[model samples]
Target: MAAPAAAISAPGVLADLLPASTRARAVARDAVLVLGGAAAVGASAQVAITVPQISPVPFVLTTFTVLLLGAAYGPLRAGLTLALYLVAGMAGVPWFTEGASGFGFPSFGYIIGFLVAGVAVGWLAGRGGDRTVLKTAGLMVLGNVIMYAFGTPYLAYATGVGAAQAVEWGITPYLIGDAIKLVFAALLLPGAWWAVNKFRSQD
Candidate 1:
């Protein structure tokens, strides 16, 4: 029988950086990645700054982390990382924003969006979208759009507000922050690539 696939064989920037010579080594690397990546995302979710004006949707670093993870890990592992985070949070890990955890929370939609964004960003990164600043930023913008696609409608439904109100509360208020995040996330992948190349040259 053919060997089983590695946990993180899906192509992306980080996968290229961490290639393994053997299937066994690849599997080991993937194991560490699955667990460590999930934990890192969970921890990032905890860096929440509540905008009372944007209650139920605090300004957290989760989105930034999600985008970065996806660009680094590829779609499958990035999606799995977010899924594991959701499961742990739902199971009362208190890792969600402001130490909150549950399925019924209004902000839960964004968490779901994280999974979608992860896949989208990872796919784009795998396609070399992450190699350049502009392309990477564009991919991050797409990821952000995917996030709001889930988040906006859910915000409307959960709060019993109209679509306009949902946009007002959940979308508009965060546009600047999201843009800032996209720029940073966009820069990260290319920067990592530069760092990797630099380190390789030193060897």
Candidate 2:
């Protein structure tokens, strides 16, 4: 029954968020992407101005979107969706807050990080938690780790710093916000299930 529901309702609204095709889904995917982008921008509220002496990357809150998409959309869509996100930013969308654009420095690794971490989230949705909040939270944490791995080096090279300093440069400032987002993402899975259970109980 559960699998049937996932399959039956997969089109139109839920699964429709991403088009599996190369062309037709492009417009739909772009429109759907705006929501995720807005959410991502929302999560990272204050743009940490890049101090050239420190680093050239401005801080933003896309991680929340990263986790959200991974859990809500699953691996393939989530991964591709976020990948498109980075691509858009690279193409000069101001999506990154540099007040400038293009794929260069600090962002490269973090982009890769998003992919690495998101993979865990999407994979965990199946293996770790099953659309439950707690497991989702755990998976997100696992995925967030990949962000650190990718972000560390850019911090070091561009800022003329070391590993610890690199961590300080980017990852540390956002730690508090990231924690809160993690909790929010964790609850999303359980909350979703609760809603499903409520409707099911009506039967």
Candidate 3:
């Protein structure tokens, strides 16, 4: 005899919220989570903060949203969420940062990176990486590095700039802001877990 549905392990915040008794409900719940997560990411991308004379890339809230999604959802759903965002944007939805779309744009590299980072960070979170402040922060930094890994090279290629200048323009200007975002995400994940635990205990 198999264990009851409630005995099954819930890997992340989202899994905890969904019913595991049937495959159909699980599929529907995952679909809803992925769609909702994609919308949230798109909404965050629109909240861009521009800083001219520094770099072409503007600081956006997408990073924070991505990290949160990864921590809340697990790797597969998080990746799907980001993939949906990319596909929707490519299909002419102005959900990319600064209300832009299409595949040819240089910043789209970062968007691609978002998918990769979401998967990586979500995997980490699935393993309890986001349960502690230090571990969560480290995972957030890993996500940022993954984002820049794809972003910086494509930035150089797209802008017709040399490698050095690409670092200056695409990577350097965003370091401080990324660090701040990293810290914020790090704190937020553990705090959310604490709140979730507290609520569960009360229940």
Sort the candidates on TM-score, descending order. Answer: 3, 1, 2
Question: Which pairs clash inside model 1?
Answer: none
Local distance difference test values of all predictions, in order? 0.82, 0.63, 0.84
Residue ranges of candidate 2 with Cα displaced over 4 Å? 1-59, 128-130, 201-203
TM-score winner among the candidates?
3
- Candidate 3 on 1-203: residue-level lDDT in tens? 66654775544654455565698888888899999998999899989877768777778889889888987888999989999999999999888997888978767789989999999988988888998999998998899899999998998888898999888887888888788988888788889888777765554
How close is every model to the real structure, measured as TM-score?
Answer: 0.87, 0.70, 0.89
All candidates: CA RMSD (Å): 5.4, 5.2, 3.1
Give per-residue CA lDDT, model 2, range 75-129, as digits (tens).
Answer: 6666666676667667876655444446566556676677667656766674536
Model 3 residue runs over 4 Å out of place are: 1-10, 13-15, 201-203
CA lDDT for candidate 1: 0.82
For candidate 1, write residues 28-135 as lDDT tens digits. Answer: 887788789888888887888767666557788888888988989888878778888888888888888778888787788898899888988988888888988999
Give the Cα-based TM-score of candidate 1 against the true structure. 0.87
